[model samples]
Target chain A: MIRKWSIALLGWGAILGLLAPMLHTIWVSFSPDSFLTPPTNVWSVKWYLAYFGDRRWIHATSQSLLIAGMAALLAVAASAPAAWSLGKLTVARQRLLSILLLLPALIPPAALGFGLLPLVYFTGLWGTSLGLVLVHATVGLPIAFLIIRTCLPAKLGELEAAAAGLGANRWEVLRRVTLPLLTPVLLAAGIAVFVLSLNESLVSIFLATPTNETLPAVIWPQLRYSPSPMVAVASCVTALLGMIGMLIVIGILGYQRGRLIAKNTTAINS
Target chain B: MQRISSWLPVFASVALVCGVVMAPLLLLLRVSLYEPATGRGFYTPGTFTFANYAIFADSHVLGIAGFTVLCGVAVATMVLAIAYPLGLFLCSLPPRAQSIAVGLILVPKTAGLLAMLFGLQRWLPRGMLATIIAEVYLVLPYSVIVIYIQLLNLDPTLRDAARGLGASPWQVFRRVTLPLSLPGIRLAFQFGLMWGLGAFLGPLFLGGPSETTLAVELHRQAFEYGRWPLAATEAVGLLIVVSIAAWGVPTVAQLRKVAHS
Candidate 1:
């Protein structure tokens, strides 16, 4: 009895530990206090308002959104054809490409980010949204690939075959059959990639300059030099974005199907 | 001709992706071979030198590398230990409750890591312990998920058979459940160690000055000092360390089978 009970206890304890910081941050964000303390009594959204009111904050948030949006879209665009192509390759060749696709995730992100830094710099694309978008889209490719490939139902092959039998040409079958089934998954992959890109921090830090600070970039310096309650608000905004992304992804895949497909996908902790 | 035509686009896409990823590593090697930056710019831009690689000889740089490995081992160990009980506890739950528990884990997980770290600093003293704790938060969700999935895949009859043979609960867990979930445990450790080796934002914002990992210092050298050569040197060092530790990635080998199947 004690042993089973102890297992339950430890499990819940881990959950509490996992949640405490986020829960506490949420509590602190609600504080009306001018500084960085949790509320004693009254809670307010003044900090959130203050955050929204600031031009720099708005601009940075917009930049983060722009980078994530563009990156996610790029990943989606590249992956469909690439994943389709992957299906055509020899098994060994497909495995090699799969590993290659996921290589960015496997590497030390610092190594990954810094390697891109020189590429960005020498290309004179430093502090450019396009540069960051390219980097993020590259990083996001695997997750996008994984989701799309997994979600590419086997029925797709059957449907394509039927279309071919009916005399639909290659492009015609792809246009009519492969694309229709793919539309929903591509949409979900885009959202997944978007969330991953927005939440990405380490690479953003190295690549972002004053001219192109994403929200994480904005939050980075404040963390070291000038900490504040409004920063908490900014953090909350990002937390909120992550929350919405999760709900949207869940909504798209539907709970049961998402769970089923996600079995192979794992958590993309980017 | 038809076969060749179909193969072309697939090869093109794969080549593009491989080039993007591999180009950086190759670039890092090329850049690291350049002279250390002078007043002119990030580097001399035309000169060759190996002086930057000499940083690995410095005790301070070596310490940072050692600390990174230590942190990785520690985080991976703790995450794996926690995952076992969490996995079983999750199994004991009803279906609806299981999903809720998963949501609890997933919410904090997908919630921006930086945001969680910021909140963590306020909640705990902002330093190494806090950084490790935040990493635990960073990794624990997936570890639980991995372990739970592995546990779910177990043949319940095997465990029951052990229990029916008069084995104690602990004995059954030790002999049957633990051995069976070995793959999950290994995977969870791999996940933890991979992030731990490359642990960046945790030590960056949450950790103390002494806790600087190569990633943090790479940022400092490159951006703070405009020392691109040095940053590239450290990037190469980081890769070497990761590849060394990554030998244990049975997951990659596992994925190879899954990809083809």
Candidate 2:
């Protein structure tokens, strides 16, 4: 009972710990003060208005969305085939290829960002949306690939074989059987890609041109030089968006697991 | 024939992406030696120099590396200490309690480091203590998640059998559950150490000059100093330390597994 009480307290403390930052952020967001001093008087949305009214924030936000959207789509598209081939295909260098694909993820992200900085600079892609998209996608690829690998069924092999026996061509099998099965993983990967790209300050800051500044990039200098309540507001918004994205991914995964379990039960009953 | 042709386009595009990804890494290794005196930038082919590696011999930089490793080890230890009790509590609880506990633990992870850094910067006591607190906060959730997964997957029959043999709950846990969870413990430590080693944004916010880590040092070199070769050396050194820690964890785990078997 003592152990249980302590565990419960820890659990509650963790919840409180998670909320404290967000609550502090929200408080700071509405404070009339420029600095993130604890509010003395009536809390106002003055900082929120400043944030929303600011042209730089607006432009940075749009650029962030544009880059993140493209990164998500491109990352998922590129990784899908690689993951499919790895998961379903029997190849001579399967293990080696899988390791190769995961190599980007295994390497320190800081190292990867440094490495890419030179390439972006020399290629004249530093300030371009395309450059940002490709860099984000590169960082996001291993994650997308890993998510797809775990979520795809090992029984895909037998399922494809069965579909082929039933006179389904390869394309037809992929379209009818594989794509539907992959929908949840696709959504999960998409959410992950979007969130990762959205929160990518290091890569974006490294490659940011004045024209292509991301939300985090805009907030980073402010974080260093002039950490006003505005930075708090931006941080809160980013954190909220990240939490929502994570929830969407987790929810889809849970629903998919439930569906799989139900299907298994029905199969057993039949 | 049309299907195969259409598929070829998609495959080709992916191949192109692979090429694009590979280029940067190759360029980083090559450009680390370039003196930057030439009008050319990172991609320009240049002669290699040991100068970049030589600057890393600075005692200050080496001290930062030592401090970062120490912080990582400290965080890893704290995370394991925190996670084990939480993991035990989770496994012992009813299903609803377990879900609630896990959800609470995971909430911080989804919030990202930025928000925590923002809050910590303003609220927490400054210096190495704050950095350590934040590092522990950042890694503890991950540690719990990893250990919880392992504990949840633990074979219940062994515990039941131990109880049937008249062993107390504590003994059963110490003998059975603790040993079973060691792999998960090692994994948590690995992840905690990796995260703490690369702790840039957190330290950037909470840390003082005294607490400057390798990651912070690398950032300072690159952006603040504009010394690309020096930055590359610092980055390479950070990678070496992190890689050794990463490589060490699994080797130790495997050895433990072998010994136990």
Best-fitting candidate, scored by lDDT:
1
Q: Which pairs of residues collide in model 2?
A: none
Q: Provide backbone clash counts, one per model.
A: 0, 0
lDDT of 1 by residue, B1-261 (tens): 998776665564465456556887899999999997668788888889898899999999999988888888888888888877888899988876776677677776665666677777877776779778767777778788889988998999998899999999889989999877878887788878887888887787778888888888888898789888888999899888778777756664576588799
Q: Pick by TM-score: which candidate is best?
A: 1
Per-candidate interface C-alpha RMSD? 2.2, 3.6
| Candidate 2 CAPRI-style tier | acceptable
List candidate 2 segments past 4 Å from native: A87-99, A153-155, A260-270, B1-22, B36-45, B90-104, B250-254, B257-261
Cα displacement (angstroms), candidate 1, residue B162, comes to 5.8
Clashes of 2: 0
Candidate 2: Cα lDDT at A264: 37
Best by DockQ: 1
Model 2, DockQ value? 0.39
lDDT of each: 0.80, 0.74
- State residue B33's C-alpha deviation in candidate 1, in Å: 1.0
Candidate 1, position B147, lDDT: 93
